[model samples]
Target chain A: MRKLSRSSGDVGKKITETIEAVSEAIEDTLVVSRKFARQDEETLGNAERIIDSVLRRFSRAASGLTESEELLRTENNAINYEISDVFVALQFQDRVSQILALVCDDLNKLEQHLNELKSQQADEGSSRSVNVEQWLEELSKTYTMEEQLTAHDGTKAEIKTDQPGITFF
Target chain B: MAKTILFVEDSASVRQVMNSTLTREGYDVILACDGQDALTRLDGSKIYLIISDVNMPNMDGLTFVKSAKQMPAYKSTPIIMLTTETQEVKMNEGKAADVKAWIVKPFQPAQLLAADSQLIQA
Candidate 1:
């Protein structure tokens, strides 16, 4: 029998650090994403409001301007439409933030599961999987995300949430 | 009276988007954060449809759909899974739960609206 080197590092500390790191990352993401998202939303909303006000104010002022000056109105209208398009495009961030939030949730669950695995590892050499197979089955029944299934697919861990397809069950 | 749809999703932005869109389309929307919350929202209200995210905190979509189907009113009320998953195992699990439709996420509002209309009309 080949004897592997006995590792002296504290496994408990490593697991604790990993979980803490994940929690910290999640908190940081939540704080930063929310802050930036709020700023982005305000910027977009103000742009729309400014556009609306400019359009209303300019259309009235345009009545008194020369034909050449009225060309600026057309250009302003185009600019406002472009600004609106940018606002719509920024909505993609909402979708991305939603996905990132879900990732944090998974990290939280992973920490819990890791803690459970560590506890089982310390209790003799009994296989936790063997003892908890039934529990695992029921545990999956409580799944709440498509990512959970994608993670277990054993193929490419591709998370294609943007694709639109429907199947009847 | 407008038709009521129960939407179970954990994200506030997603819920807001869906609620606004559906409300604009003349439907009343009730919301829940997850499957367990969805069960509580049931509250014997007349719901025309149930749309849910597959992965959620507290309870998952598959189990919720299965549990909801156990009820008489919900058995006939169609359910659509709005998720990012395309795995056969997940599809099978949803099928077992009696989910009527599986619409992958990042979907167009029209796509789901069309499905909702078709199912409701049927």
Candidate 2:
């Protein structure tokens, strides 16, 4: 076996830099996604307004055609319902943002830990290793969603749709 | 007159969605970006109900609920927490803060409206 020596400080520094870069990228993505979501909402709002205006004008012009007016009204209601569903789907951005924020926080912490290890290696000629179990426990404590825990445990998380997690006290 | 509801969430998209949904249901909505901003919006207005996100910058939802409950004007107003957080500990904290309902995020607009209808009388 050939022995290839790499300093712990060098390894730690590389890891820290990588983590920091990833965290920054995640943060930037969050900002861009939020901006896009706002723009999407505005565009949807405008479309809804235009549709409503056209529907109202059509109804007024064709007041004598009662059956056609009713059909138009029904179609308008269905469109509005679909728009509402889009809004609900848009909420995925919020959850994704939250999960990414948490990941960013964890990355920052990991970066900090690496930096500390690098400093220790420089000062003491040896790096103190993190306790994997304790670190995992600490990470689990920060999770707020059940999916996070399930993911951490390497289990498939149940995908919840239409089932509202509601509890009244 | 339409009943007023104060909705607080940090995400702009969620705010827009909630505003549209609540307004469409004939409820007047007041939007705030966070708990701190929500506190400022609670300037003695006759809010029929409140919907808040659990985790937010400046102040979290439970803290805001506790502070809001302290106020004489909104002491008895019902609050529904609409958040991604599913931790039981946080829910217990919310209950202690007088939060009437907890609805997890990505919830259907109908579920939220149903909760609103249940909490606030028509």
Q: Which one is best on DockQ?
A: 2
Question: For residues B1-122, what per-residue lDDT tens digits would candidate 1 score against the true structure?
Answer: 89999999886767877787789789999999999999998877689999998877799888899888888878889989987565778888887787889987656666778989988887
lDDT of 2 by residue, A1-169 (tens): 1233356667788999999999999999999999999999999999999999999999887786887779989998898788767867777777778889989999899899989998988999975888889988999999888888998888987747756579989
User: Under CAPRI classification, how is model 2 graded?
Assistant: acceptable
- TM-score for each predicted model, relative to the true structure: 0.51, 0.74
Candidate DockQ scores, in order? 0.19, 0.48
Q: Isolated chain A: TM-score per model?
A: 0.37, 0.57
Superposed Cα deviation of residue B91, candidate 1 (Å): 0.8
Q: How well is candidate 1 docked (DockQ)?
A: 0.19
- Model 2, range B1-122, lDDT digits (tens) per residue? 99999999898877887798899889999999889999999999799999999899999988898999999999999999988888888988899888899998778777888999999983
lDDT of each: 0.76, 0.88
What TM-score would candidate 1 get against the native?
A: 0.51
